[model samples]
Target: MPTFNVKLPMILSLLLIFLALYVLALRGHFSYVAMRAGNYRFSKIESFNSLALNPLMSFSFALRDYQKDTLDLKPANMERLEELSKIFPLFSTTPKNDFALKNPPHIMVNLMESFGTQMLSLQEGNLNLLGELAQHFEEDFVWTRFLPCQNGTASSFFCLFFQSPIVLSKSKYKEHYLPFIPIEVYKQQGYRVIFLTAGNSTWSDLGFFMKAQGADEIIDEVALLQDYPNSSKIHFHSHYGVGDEFMYQKALELLSSAKEPLLILTLSVSNHPPYPEVPILFSKEQIPLEIFDKIPKNTSAILNTYVYANNEFARFLSKVKQSELKDKLIIAATGDHRVRGVAMDFNTEKALAYGVPFYLYVPKAYQGEIVYDKTRIGSHKDIFPTLYALTLSETRFLHLGGRNLLETQENDKFAFGFNAEVWIDNEGIYPRSSNLGYKYKDNQSLLSTEESFALDEEHLEFHKIYQEFLELQLRYKLLNLAQ
Candidate 1:
């Protein structure tokens, strides 16, 4: 008993316990671990154990698995590529000329932050979330059954430009020059590609990434401040920088002095979280009592910013419509993701949770026989393909996986969100987490999920094809990175 040294053993045991808890907490914070198991405690524990054993060991195991999968799927990748090439032709030298415009219309893509359809669809008699943007939804072509490429702002933005999901560890932007990027295609067609954002471009390496992808100019918050010294900053969460109104003003100025065919991509920031107080001209009394009850405690602030973003966008659209650029511009706008902080059951409301409106305004000159089918399912990936077909002539660009939404073919009318873990079609919505699918009815004003049901074979087949397409894209990306 004297030689046992119980105190030393107790201290060592305590230290070991502390170290174990520390490791668990540390592992829990890792993005990769959190991404895999954010909700489930058991899954998180497993992830922690795997990480604590050896952090690099997981990577090693993943690498081995990837290698094995690559070897087995190499032939399948080629086959898939060939099949996809036939579906989405690699070279479209002949412009669709449906609009028969005198000149190639200037392309303007507006990426609205947190403009979630869940909140937008809540617009009833008095509860108006869109504000000034409501009329445009009626006048322009908007696809209600739409999903974004991913849920997060940065990922959605990257996917919209790259036509593929962002690879977290080694992004294509970091590894190699992507040949099939829309910006590069626009550049090759003699269009000056400019990216404008009210937020800091360096936040997610956005400016660098855009420049790498062949954007001629990246006008971010720094440039915005320099250009418009009088512009007011949203100091509450200052990373978002100036308001959307100022950014739109800058865009207007650029449009006036354009020397060549221009493609301007504007990313708005006012609708984002930590919703700061902006000039709220709209009345809060418009919100219906029932709808107001559903939102978070900061409903007033969130709605104010939401309306502010829409009002600024509407003002920009009105100005463009009144100006000479109206006839020369092809405007496309969509939300980066659904508005966060909304409480909903994912099992029942996956479509509503991830839904975003895809609004398009093609100049009258280019509006050939385009049928604005509101029921067609689409995402950000389809935006460029539709634009390329409209504006480019005989340009050869790689079509990773997006279908031209303008195409009348019903075969490819399906929306899939790889990062959002959801797939939707005319039949039903299939979330990756469950075997049962949810049926959603798209109405004139709102899209409401009805009941949980089983997916038909056709829907299941489409989902399978989508999964294969994503896999092929990932494999292709990994191989490119390895090279």
Candidate 2:
């Protein structure tokens, strides 16, 4: 009994001392920053180096926008720090750099929800929906691997627009106008922005987030019904509003009437769960026989539905070829996330599930000027930047971890998901996370890595910093919105 009392006091005292030291260290770091202009110059590379080594500096990296010289804590930032304390005990605020395009083109981004990369086959013998889309391309398109930040439609907004990791929590409601999002920049360039979603934009606070992205007109499920009272007959309906076919038709309509230099964001709903038995736009005759052979026997409803959506998408593209906007528009297609249906035994199916496919369709006019490689490895975070680079000449994005694909970089490309991450380069796909990890030298020699092992520890450390920066950036934006 006496030993317990004595040890209890000693333990308490030791904890108090440790706490005191931690507080002192924090104060010293802040004070040092205040005393100097910058302890270290803020280059993306230099910041990454410091972030990997110093936790405190990394925390600062989250709070302080390196683009801003002053580090004074604003009221909005204070609120952000308080809220962020739950996740990051010592997080703060900062600004980031912004990039601008000289002359942006008519941009149309088609986000296919619940679509997987495996749905599209690049192999010559394979019959696939992607093959049909590739038929439209005359060596002007780039087929590459892309990773979504998370496996949800809402998180994809941040992935594509903010060029960062998904928010840590799903319930985060507030949306901020971050400089990284292309909306404001596009607006400045006199581009008329339109957002069309075939589903309820409110499904994932997507409507709210899209508005924050500066959409001049957000045509959602409600809007679709109101616009076309006979939408039921004209459009297929499931859990969402109109189907992919109707959405594409609407997109084409908008494109035809759209003023010069327009930006349209289309999020399709046909690929979501409770997959349709029939294709929305395509007849059986229109679908190639090879696509049917690719389907496995006794396939799950989800897989069947996915194939249907893929066919419908191809049909839409076929119609687009006949439209005036074919050469007038630069189309970029990607999935919101991988298909989360029942697993299949096909090669690369698992890898494709986690990392969605990304394709860029360059108009024939600018095809020569635009740069892309079939070996390109990127994440959805790179989407906006890549699109910007293609449309605008020789430009860079600020506060984005992703580089313009046309530019060369020494760092390996990686795609981070909710619980897993994939490293993609010339080495092929290397699953780096402890969970759902795989090691592969080539497509033929793939092996699962031990789940207990942490693959690419140094690289993971860098990713951690990047994620923290995104979280902090998000928190700051939300808090700023609240104020």
Candidate 3:
């Protein structure tokens, strides 16, 4: 009996140890699958970087059919990837980069829970980066604005025409906006839409999604890559997307010729890295060319390229403004998320890094001076509705989780911030301790209350919605789902 008792504990412990090892091995096999799980675990928490290390994307060369659709699996060697799977679960994206810009880098980080500007909690001050970037890109047109919510890019695009917040499956209650389709409105209002990217139409399956959202045309790299292969191999570099400037310049040509009152959302492929170095266009230097030349060709090149692109794009935009096309152009822009795995140089904090920047530039609405509150805040999802308010468009939105960028918001708070997610704003850092909770002020913070029951309830609903959205994303065959 005594021996059995002693052995029991040892046996039980051994069993547990064996079970743990087994589970770990299983996780090793399906680490990427686990990442898509959306649960709260150490794996889920730190997996953001690992995911960034390798972004699995579906990109196609323009007009190059017959080539099987391939996922851009970075850290490409399977054996090495398997080895990495043991050490650190990493994600791989297609492409890489090396380049820099004298003008400040027009960098955008599209992290789910990462925020920039150093602060960890949500506050007005944190989101000021968008406006700051806008100012940096300032030239002949207006630059600088703000919005609300980091909800997916879905609502961010639509809310551009209204003052409402567009919600994503990942958005908070007061934050989510109605997911109203706006293409009909734009078309009815006499606007031609073109959603451009460097991937096959089926990747985002954007042909259907954009048409549903009011896009009239789709210009992907598959169509434009052949136009400029010899021009420059340099790409701005983002983890996902193609490393093609042909698409960017091609889109520019199309926009340049557009009549007027045009709404364009140009999704570029260079800034996020996993890209080839592209050449700079500007003749002048705002930042420093040496920095550009020294960038690691792997991904840092995009850092340099993004800024240069931003500078040149800003210049191009200025010329676009000057063109006979139209005078009432308002560009609503923001990063989808943050850089995937910025560990060393930049502030890639889970909270800060997950947070991307946004701002508005309306040449017609140039009456307002550059509003750098250093105290105001907002998110990606809120962009669409925020802009809609300016245009006074009749389009209604649903499922958005952001608010107007131009107005003073009361109780500006967020709930259910996902992994490494930031909960901050300009007033100060509003921290949330749980997936669901009231806005966390500096004192108690939602971050601190994350373990609370209320937060759990929030998480439950949020997760439920997320799961439903995931199912829909899969069912609908949506590629990125925008969140």
Candidate 4:
């Protein structure tokens, strides 16, 4: 009744105008969100969705255009194509290294959850809750900082095992079935490949993926429950299933009965929250109440649970030391990703979250030949190639695209972050979607926005090659070649 005085055509025109303005506003907001959020999701959506109606998609497109303005390297050239082919060669045809060791040591990879090295130290009361484990690694093993391929647990596992970037787009993931994973490689080389994890493998489709990759045995949390239905020790954490101790116990049982050379991939849990109320290891009550009281409640709870898990690990290691399997095992330890907290800034937290400690331990027999360089920067992609180099018959390239950290220098090294969206090198962090990046020298320090626009052709080439390599790998996978 109030609008009866307005003309019908005039009202329709006003409505259309308002709709257009609303769409424009939404587009602007979406652009801002894409730019702020680092465009990981934007990249995924853009990969397949040509009709991306969301304004955020438009914003992501704009940001990417700005980021890639100067870099126009194409993979279509014949010479570049050939180079990429060599860099990411056919998996089956890739020449195997011959280390010539009569007895290749049994390899064990313990991929720990939320195991960032940001506050980790040897001191008590700080994040160095794993002081004993850190000390053991420093004194006995090859210890260095390694970045994860991505932030999530599944992504980290995919990067480590598949030796490739973990692309989560529906189209990309479905098309690319990587076969260069360590499980397949170990199985091919006559090593019994066993996957042990405290979480649900089905959570990430890795249960089926790992099976397809030729895991001889896949023991996940579901299997644990089925095997130990009456055990009181089996309890689930919110994110990580069951517990670390249970997984370790099961691993030990497998180790004792293992008849062949084993490649046991053990993934630990209990580091995730809601924190478990496990018994304290040391006399924390001895510490001054003032010290404990001053800390934030959330921080205190996280640290307490963390220390408890560390204590459990120490106990597990002690058991390993006393067991006959100690000498036969080549233990490789690393965190899946950095810890996430509300206090942390997501952008700056990249360094903290991705920069996890990597420890490679060879018995005295092989330690002499292996160089334990603590300075080199590496990634999860290097896990298999390093293991291959350590115990193989000869020293040849695995062609997994990761450098053998033992042989590569820190200055020339870099790592890919989650779907190759970001590149971390010695100089700084470069976002693939935007030219804008953060430059930092130290892992703990905050990365400042890089003002200079100088593009390192080497880094650019490396990034292009990596991206093209994945694309070609997917094509090869679809054709069922070199898989």
Q: Please give the RMSD to the true structure for each candidate, in Å.
A: 10.5, 19.0, 19.8, 12.8
> If scored against the real structure, what TM-score would every candidate get?
0.76, 0.65, 0.50, 0.68
Q: For candidate 3, lDDT tens digit of each residue in 307-341? A: 44454445545554556433445555455444443
Whole-model lDDT, model 3: 0.38
- C-alpha local distance difference test of each model: 0.69, 0.55, 0.38, 0.58
Q: How do the residues 186-214 of candidate 2 rate in per-residue lDDT, one tens digit apiece?
A: 67668888888777664555655677667
Tens-place lDDT digits, model 1, residues 244-304: 8889999999988897888999899888776766766545675567655667567777778
The candidates, ranked best first by TM-score, are 1, 4, 2, 3
Sort all candidates by lDDT, best to worst: 1, 4, 2, 3
User: Candidate 4's residue-wise lDDT over 37-119, tens digit each?
Assistant: 22222222234323433567567655764564552222244455456767454332322434326666788898887777653
- The segments of candidate 3 whose C-alpha lies over 4 angstroms from its true place after superposition are 1-179, 212-214, 226-245, 279-302, 321-326, 344-350, 365-374, 393-395, 408-420, 425-483
Q: Which predicted model would earn the best TM-score? A: 1
Predicted structure 1: lDDT? 0.69
Model 2 residue 66 lDDT score: 39
TM value for model 4? 0.68
Query: How many Å off is the CA of 440 in candidate 4?
Result: 4.8
Worst 10 residues of 1 by lDDT: 35-44
